[model samples]
Target: MRIALLSYSTKPRGGVVHTLALAEALAALGEDVTVWTLGRGGDEGFFRAVDPAVHLRIVPFPDGPQNEGVGPRIIRSIAVLRDAFDPVAAKYDIVHAQDCISANAVLPSGRCIRTVHHLDQFTTPELAACHERAIVEPDAHVCVSRSVADELARGWGIKAEVIPNGVAYERFADTDPAARRAWKQRLGHYILTVGGIEPRKGSLDLLEAYALLRTKHPDPALVIAGGETLFDYRDYRARWEARAQELGVQPIVLGPVPDDDLPPLVAAADAFAFPSVKEGFGLAAMEALAAGTPLVVRDLPVLREVFADAARFAATPATLAEQLSAALTAADPRRQTAGRRLAAQHTWTEAARRHLDFYRRAGQR
Candidate 1:
């Protein structure tokens, strides 16, 4: 089958990760797959090396004025990708879009298979329109978790196919001891969270939780990595920094760690914290679990549906702090083993096979 996967950016966001890994898995299964994405900030390729079997088509998307609002940027993004992708949009057997921008771009190509990773509430007219069109315009929809699928059903009256994300189980689970030790030596006993400083990531809430955790246990430091985002969050970050100063806590902000260093970084952590307010699937948290790291996540329905008993859940900042403390101090080999087993079970091959079946069924329609 000829499949073309579309994504909004070439960055290391969760949806982009899904695109590259799924493309590789599909290619491995004797399917011809190509990934289409915008190369933001002059990027010519993805954050990491992709599989040789899967083809790449990176459309150049230049940066706008530094002060340009998100609405205009989103409009420009759709225009650039749509112009580049429209000519070849009809050539693929499946035109699957991974995000709102990509889905909006290829929405006019007659048929679209959109993966609603998560829904966002937008106020800007252009963004809200883009979000709604991406949700309802697609011929078929796919969601990464059953909770999100249920949301589509209840809110939009759309029955999206439920397809959970697959993690790189062996890559994280097999980190070398020396590499893990190197990270541990550099940052002694830290609580780590990825996905940069953004509102949806609940960065402010995490900051408060970390401060509370320090009141009782001052041994563990807070380490934050991976904050590459297209949206402007300087205000939110400033608030976070101001709050950090007010609380007399300094979190090590490592913005966008190299791809190779991610696994060891996850492995060396005393505990991994995921305080996202909205998430279709907790991909980074799952990676931490694969590395045999204790996990503490916000009590969200999607996370509960996905992580199940493998993670400790917390609803409030105080509860989150408590959970992090417990994760750092307690040694529950049983939950650790369960986490590893859960991560191992969500393989890309199985995901690709299910996607192929979905494509075949959708094509019949």
Candidate 2:
């Protein structure tokens, strides 16, 4: 089948990573999948980073200032949608939108399906309106987790199919001892947390918890890895660092690492800690499990669904620290083995098969 995967922002974020993985898997299964994106004129390095097997089409826009105002941003987005859809919509059998925000303006024609990563938690009236419109109008909606689906049904009265995110397992199988040793020398015996520095990600809470743990384990460093420039959430990292200093905790913040470097970085961790307030699907935690690193994550519904009995769950950062400490001190070979086995089952190939099945069924309706 010919499919068009539509996304507004195709940066190397979690959602974009998921989209690219699924697209690559679908192409491997002998499907014609083309990714449609807004052409953000850079060195095109990011697009080159994606697997060459998957097809890509960048819809162009007129030249303008580096950063446009809100009004111009909306106008430019509309222009991009028009340009993308004019030539491609009739040729493809299916169009799968990657996010509700992008789907809001593009899916009203009833020619596409939307996958809701999560609802907009922004308090802005315009953002809320856009989210409501997308939630109510999609031909069909797919959610990344059951918790997300439930929230949509409860709050917006929309029933969405739940499909969990999948990982590229083979990437984490091999180890590089030299790389690990270099990272270890830079940040010794550190507790790792991977995600963008944001308030909802619990970066501040992690600092608080690390402070509490420092009295007993004075030298165990905390490493924060992910993109540093979160446009809306830029203050979160500064606030966290200030708090860490005040509490006298050993905190090292390493901004985003490359995709190829992620596996070794995750594997090198003494233990992985995820103190997020919420998640549609905890991809980093899953990666940790595949790397055979012990996990300490928030005891939330979605996390429970993903890790089940394989991970140690804690509700608060203090509890998270305690659980991580215990896991690090007395490593369980059986649990690590079981976690790796479970992680193996959640491969991108399987996720792509499920997505294809859903697309076929949805198209028939």
Candidate 3:
């Protein structure tokens, strides 16, 4: 089977990671897979992370900066659609689009599948229209989580199949003890949070929770690994830094660690905390689990679906802090065992096979 995975921008975001994982998984399963993405900076990096057998075709779109205003973004998305769908668009048996916002508008007119990542702040009226068109036109639709599928049914009256994202099993298998020690020596004893420092991600709430945690545990540092804020959410990074200073917490903001360094960083961290209020799927939490690290996650429905009985759930900042404290102090053998077992159940190979099955079924329809 030949597949064309369509995504507007394949940056270092979770959606991009999902697309790459599925593509590589399909390729590994003896399917001819080609990733069609908006030409972005981390294209080479993303491909390097995938299996070497997988093929990549980047379609560069003449779009404004990613942080541009809504008007320019819409115009740029239109331009992208025109360019991306003009040539060689109908060559594949399946065109799987990631994210319901942009890729939904530009897929070719055959067996197309749009994967809804989430429906939080990025869901605008234009995005809704694009998703509606895709739902009516495509042969099948997928959602990363049940919460997102339910939201699609409620908001746009479109039903979608649920397919959870998978993680690369080998990437987190067990770090070298020497390398782990070296990373600890370099970064110190720190609590790690990996994601963009934006408002919707609950970075401010994390800072508030971290401040409270610092009152009890002052020695461990807080290391936030992600890119600069790209949303219009009032510069939460600045506020976090100011609040951390006022509270006398040692906070280190490492803006987006390289892909090669992520595994070691995850292994070196004492614990992982993800206080996201909204997420279609919690990939970071999965990464932490894969690394045999314990996790404290927000009590969001999607997260609950992903973690199941593997993670400690907290609904608010205070509860989050309490959970973090417990996670820090106690030896959670059950959580560690459960996390490793759950991580083992989700593999890129299995995910890719399921995707190929879906594509073949969609093509028949």
Question: Which candidate number would show the highest TM-score if scored against the true structure?
Answer: 1
Instruction: Return the candidate ranking by TM-score, descending.
Output: 1, 2, 3
Return model 2's CA RMSD, one decimal. Answer: 2.5
Q: Candidate 2: list runs displaced more than 4 Å.
A: 39-48, 60-82, 228-230
**Model 2 lDDT tens row, 151-263:** 88899888888888888666775668787787888888888998867877888878887787777777768888886321355456678767777887767777778767788
Q: Between candidates 2 and 3, name the one with more favorable TM-score.
A: 2
Relative to the unseen true structure, what is the C-alpha lDDT of residue 355 in candidate 2, on a scale of 0 to 100? 90
Clash count for candidate 3 is 0
- lDDT string for model 3 (231-306, tens) is 3545566787777788777678787777778888988898899988889888888989989887999998889888
**What's the lDDT for residue 47 in model 2?**
31
Quote the lDDT for 264 in model 2: 86
Better of 2 and 3 by lDDT: 2
Alpha carbon lDDT of each predicted model: 0.94, 0.77, 0.76
lDDT of 3 at 28: 73
Off by over 4 Å in 1: none
